[model samples]
Target: MPAGGLDIRTFDAVKALAFIGDLSMGQPTDHSLRTAWLAAQIAGAASFRADICDTVREASLLRWSGCTANAAEFTNTFGDDVEGRAAMLAERPDWAELLNAQGGPAQAIAPLAQIHCEVSGEVARILGLGSETEATLRHIFETWDGNGMPNQLNGKAVPAAVFVVALAGDLEIFSRVYGLEHALVLIAHRANFRYPATLTIPVNTHAAQWLDTLAQLAPAALDAALLTPQMQHSTSPDLIADVLDLKLPWMTGYSRAVATTAAACCARLVADPEASERVYRAGLIHGIGRAAVPNAIWDTPTRLSAAQWEKVRLVPYWTSRAGKQMGTLDQATELASYAYERLDGSGYFRAVGGPALGLEARILAASAAWVALRSKRPWRDALSDVAASELLRTEAEQGRFDSDVVEALLEGEPTATQSASPRNIRYAAETTRLSSREIDVLNLISHGASNKEAARALNLSPSTVRTHVERVFRKLECTTRAAATLKASAMGLLR
Candidate 1:
């Protein structure tokens, strides 16, 4: 077993994330787990090697990891009913037919598929899956007839494990949604095109038995049974954080940075070792809920609608729920759930404030604010150390942020420089169309500044500030200050 007690439980934790991925894709929570279980059963029927069967199971559970990263693009192209549509498409044998039916051009869908595959491979690597497993995941959609997205590997060119997962995933869905006979017919029809004949034969022969066994086993029991010793793997808080951060390009290293800074603050505040560790872990996974939100919102340079803002607020709540599902992460997840909360009860998901917010939560909030300020975002440039510190102090004075926590963060690193690299800064600027002045107005407004205060801060007239605010609102498609702030924060535009 690897150090830190990850062991087989790590696989369970990954499966939990896959469960979240299922929800993100608009499927039932057990969708990925059921797929993994079904895939393993099919692999067993095919008499595949033990290691290959394991890979098939892992790949099946994680097949949709990329979907979190590409959800915005998918929703924008396909519509808000992505889950139903995606399920429908998955049942179809022809990818080209589905795309044509959806009125999505192949050229547009191709890059999305490539990104999805690449991100899936990255998740596999981060979770320490072997090269074979990683490769299988990358080629999960490649068809037997060289007609799949991202890559068109034909026949034996596609990984055998991937073929097993492909057939099993479809079989599970079809069998569950339709009857066994109809599922068999669908499998037979797609035998030579969607899945290789070799794999399809085994699936067709044992489809009923596999379906019956899956139906008999409880999802929890199935998960427990699959956590065999050999499935154990090494993982750490950083690895998990990377997986969550992969949901958005702009949030690439946000979690790790927050964890690092939060740990430092905890140390400076003389927190117990356990408290420090818990806070660090909490900071790392605090944004796990981000995966549930569409990237279009994260990437939107403009303001979000009130409906969109509602989705943004629930991210922390989702993170808490996800943590609760993992037996080992209950405490840390609770802390993470408070990462977005403010001392003044203005925070979201749960509006608990003041005494309800503990020391650890305060440190997390301060550290998160500090890190975000130092990171480049689409609406504004990274704040200078002096400016960020001043902002924190100002918020504290207004009873919104914790003054002691803010001081602890500042004292933890008196000379800390901005951590946003030049490349990231450039990337943020390039992807956003907001001008520096407009960004300035938005930033002030996000912090609860009225037009007059914003005007004074930027050395402009109140009327000019109002005009800038209107322009910002118009560009962002928002009607209220709260909506603008929520939208800006979702896009990583706020500290």
Candidate 2:
């Protein structure tokens, strides 16, 4: 049984989030999944205990959790070259070579590596992982010869699972990119220097068979295979959200804050326990999709162009997709995807309206907006609570937000000072240049409503609705509903 009576589903959810880590590292979508599978197999072949196998698998999947915070540093030093960075990492360069190649001083590399390891370990702790797993993650890059970047533990001093994972990760990558024989060669070359001889010997002996097993493995099958009954103690959804929130400096603690505030609001509204929990979960991961966008875009201190804004709008869609990968989180994920939507059908990724938007989604949106207003952005300072409330009230009054949701958010807050009005706040004005009717038609189409259904809803003839949609496409400089929706969302035309 899981310690603390936590559900096994929590582990399943964490495994799913590993895919996001893979993306952040610029690897294939299933890189983490494959790494975990390979690591577990290597552990089993080496006769590791069942618990050790489980820890290895978990550690391998989450080894890159620290990359979210370190990506900007990598980009700044390496200039967005994924393959180059991969090559540099594969060579296992010393601190001097790494800094020299990246055009940074040798002194800067140690602190960066240390920060990455510490952050990864912290995330593991927050997720309730065992200390062994956390230690393995922290020492993931440490080598057998005591020449690793963060720590220089030699031979047996390195954590067993970390050694196993380091070899397994490279095995999967080389085997996939090169071939089975080449992967074995690479392992042999690095043996006794980067990986333990005991682990690498078994891998060398059964290279072909191991590669065969991994070749047949699929990303979707990973969770069922790795998350065995004994593999308990999964991280809660809220903690998973926090892991994603760490990706941006501005977004730190944003997800947890939203989840807590939203859950409290749900309780105040007298929602049932289930409803409150669902909203809380949704709030926790509402920004999970933000990972798909680059940190450069997120950290930019200027207005986003139309294309960049479209990328921002699709974050919620990506979050929903990530959530859907876990069987138990489907509902919460769906609500999270709607976090950027509005009551008046002004959301991006999907232009949903009042009828289609659920109460949980409304509360999630309200809470996210409230938290964001209070948090500092690259372009602006954090808003005072009263100022945020006033801005949210203005949004509600304009029909972009639900009045009830806004009221619930502001019930206990002090009134805004006179200086906090819209006239004083620097708002990103709507620039999509779409008329109200065009926006209406776009919203209907976004919800997958047929032209006839849209006509019925808007009380117009099918011909009129079609004309309006066509004009929306033309005006937005797009040819399809999907493109138009994205563009409009990026333009901030949607609520």
Number of the predicted model whose lDDT against the real structure is largest: 1
TM-score of each: 0.73, 0.73
TM-score of model number 2: 0.73
Candidate 2 lDDT, tens digit per residue, 362-383?
A: 8888888888888678889888
**What lDDT does each candidate get?**
0.71, 0.70
Ten residues in a row with the worst lDDT in model 1? 417-426
Per-residue C-alpha lDDT of model 1 across residues 58-155, encoded as one tens digit per residue: 88888887665555456666554244344554555454555677666456576667666766775675566778888997887888888887767776
Q: How far in Å is the alpha carbon of 375 misplaced in model 1?
A: 2.7
What lDDT is reached at residue 285 by model 2? 72
Q: Root-mean-square deviation of each candidate, in angstroms?
A: 11.0, 17.9
> How far is 378's C-alpha from truth in model 1 (Å)?
2.9
